[model samples]
Target: MLLDALVNTTDAVASTRSRLAKVEALAGLLAQLEPDEIAPAVGFLLGKPRQGRVGVGWRGLSAAMGAPAAESSLTIADLDALLDRLAEASGAGSAGDRSRELGEFTALATEREQDFITRALLGDMRTGALEGVLTDAVARAADRPGDVVRRAAMLSGDLGETARLALTGTAEELDAVGLVVGRPVLPMLAATAASTSAALETTGEASVEYKLDGARIQVHRAGDEIRVFTRSLADITHRVPEVVEVVRNLPVRDVILDGETLSLDEDGAPRPFQETMSRFGADAARETVLHPWFFDILHVDGRDLLDEPLSTRLAELERVAGAHRIPGEVTADPEVAERVSRDAIEAGQEGVVVKAIGSPYAAGRRGSSWIKVKPVHTFDLVVLASEWGYGRRKGWLSNLHLGALDPTGEFGEPGGYVMVGKTFKGLTDELLRWQTEYFPQIEVRSSAGTVWVAPTTVVEIAIDGVQRSSRYPGGIALRFARVKRYRDDKPASEADTIQTLRALLRE
Candidate 1:
């Protein structure tokens, strides 16, 4: 298929706020794609290239812009091949080679195609076709069940591969995409509640587990081999050998454990989040030893527990994890839940997560089955832009412009971020220096004092609450907002949404 066809479909998807319309447009395009082209096309539509980062940034992209072709002649295969070559470019002269290759590729694409490619490369595709919408479209195009396609996508942790399988492979093959011991599946996510009582109300007879302020790790063990993955499904096995050893000592021969790992001080108190992340990101061994705490077990001894209830999984986890199991209590009493929350906080944990005892693990989906409660109102928002600091903090990026996701375009462009507020508080000098050095690399444009970025950085912001305001496009402003930390472990697509913040007004 021609690249123009996919670009036109994305444009159509972005032009409408109706999700059905976007799905229909995407489905129509998906049906026309050849079996081999489905995966790359899906990746491009999702604003992520299958080749991953190709070392091409905004500056490199700008240098590559040239006169566009009058007509559309580039095929999807041609674009994928170009990206493959660009991804393979490395070594000393890789930058110049990438620029030259990008220039040649852009010269052959039409204006619309160029814009689409640019947005895709920058992870800024604003089409309303999010993964859920696109999954529906894929199912519609392939004449398969939506649940089947969704399960396949979630278990495989690859929507592109799921699309290829659903479109070209048999239904049995698609359904057969089960949990593998080493490959990481998408981690289950949680919704939020105001308090432990509120969370328990949503999940009756719940397991109120401590919500640790640490890095999420998914450990997979088969025989003696172990691997660790982050919340975003990035492999960090080599960086965390201690975690591997802990999982390696598990009683089961094969198991999949979901949990958190963090560095602790001599007093057994959790270290600062940045300290844990620094240790987690480093490949070399450090003095800080990270302790693994398992909360849920997905698979053990060839028994897949994902379809099992939380009660069952907890039983399995208790049997195998022993001292490594996260602290929690299974109770229906609201008072008991509140006590657990207090205990967790006093223990230097975040708060508590109330999970329904009978609820199955819903990977990649955030539902009310598991609800987290914390004292402070915190949200993972995207960094839309940043302004230059002044006075004593001069020459650094200090003020951060925050945005919330609008997946349905209720407040703005579909699958785009809507600016809600800005904050300069809570940033240390180190953070300011990091921001100054980082933002420009992903910058799309700049004004007199602000540099607009690609809205790809996810930062955790603590707020008193949100109030109705006309100052921002989202009709709400954050009250007393401050940065808690930068969530490098999370993605912008998974950040909290505008609708979520608007719901706070009711609270």
Candidate 2:
């Protein structure tokens, strides 16, 4: 298939607000793709190339641009092959090699294709074609059940692969996709609630476990060999040997555990989130040892517990995790849930996750079955732009332009960020310096005082809640918004949604 075909379909999808129309357009495009082209095409549409961050950035992309080709000739296979080469370019003189290759490739692309390729490479494709919509499109193109494709995608933690399977393989083959002990599945997500009581109301007879201020980890152990993956599914087993050793001593021979890992101070209190992440992202061993606390067990021995109720999974988690299990109690009483929440806060943890006792694990899905209640309103928001500092803080990028995700174009363009508020609060001199140095590297555009970035940075912001406002497109603004920290572990796509903040009006 030609690259123009995919680019035209993306344009159609982005130009419409109707989700059904977008899915139909994408499905039509998917139906025409060859089996081998499906994954790369899906990845490009989602703004994530299958090659994964080919060391290319906005600067690199801009440096390589040239005049466009008049007519379309580039094939999907050609683009994929180019990406493969770019991804492999590394070492002393790799930068020049990539520049040459990118320049050559861009010279053959038309204006629209050039824009699509650049956005796709930078993961800034605000095309309204989110993963869920594309998953539905894949199902439609392949004439497969939506649930089947979704399940396979969630289990495998790779939508591109799932798209290829749904389009090329049989329905039975897709259905046969199951939890493997070694492969990390997408971690289950949680909805937000105002209080423990509210969360319990959504999840009756729940396990109200402590919500830690730590990184999400999925540990897979197979006969003493353990692999640890972050929330994004990047393998970091070597960096966290302590976690590996801890999982290795588990009672079961093979297991898949979902949990959090954080460094603790001498008094055993959880350290600041940045401290934990600094240690977590290190490539070499660090003195700051991280401790793992398992909350749910998905696999034990040969039993798959994902289909089991939370009650069953927690039981298995407790048996296998033993002392490493996270603290919580199963209860239907609101008072008990509230006590757990209070206890978590007093222990310096975030809050409580009230999970339904009878609900099966819904990987990658944020449903009412599991709700998180934090006493303080904190959200993961994207940094849309940064403003130049003035007065005493001169020369630094001081105020942040924050945005909430609008995946369905409820308030604006689909798969776009809706600005909700701005804040220069809670930033230290160190943070300001980092922002000044980093924001320009990802710059998409700039005005007199503001530098618009690619909306790829996720920051944890604490607010006094939200208030209705006409100043922003989301119909709400964050109250007393301040940065808690930058969530380097999270993707901008996972930022809290405008609907989530808008719902605060009722409270």
Give the runs in model 2 whose Cα sits over 4 Å from its true position.
Answer: none
Whole-model lDDT, candidate 1? 0.92
Please give the RMSD to the true structure for each candidate, in Å.
1.0, 1.0
Each candidate: what lDDT?
0.92, 0.92
In candidate 2, residue 348 scores what lDDT? 99
lDDT of each residue in 1-507, candidate 1, tens digit only: 999999989888888899899889999999999988999999999988898888888888888999899999999999999999999998999999999999999999999998888898998898878999999999999999999999999999999999999999999999899899898999999999888888887888999999999999999998988889999899999999899888777778999999999999999999999899989989898888999999999999989999999999999999999789999999999999999999999999899999999999999999999998998999999999999989988999899999999988888888889999999999999899899999987889998899999989999999999999999989999999999899989989999999999999999
Residue 196 displacement in candidate 2 (angstroms): 0.4
* Model 2: per-residue Cα lDDT over 99-202, one tens digit each: 99999999999998999888988788898888899999999999999999999999999999999999999888999999998898888999999999988887
Q: Return the lDDT, model 1, position 360.
A: 98
Q: Which ten residues in a row have the lowest lDDT in candidate 2?
A: 313-322
In candidate 1, stretches whose alpha carbon ends up further than 4 angstroms from where it belongs are none
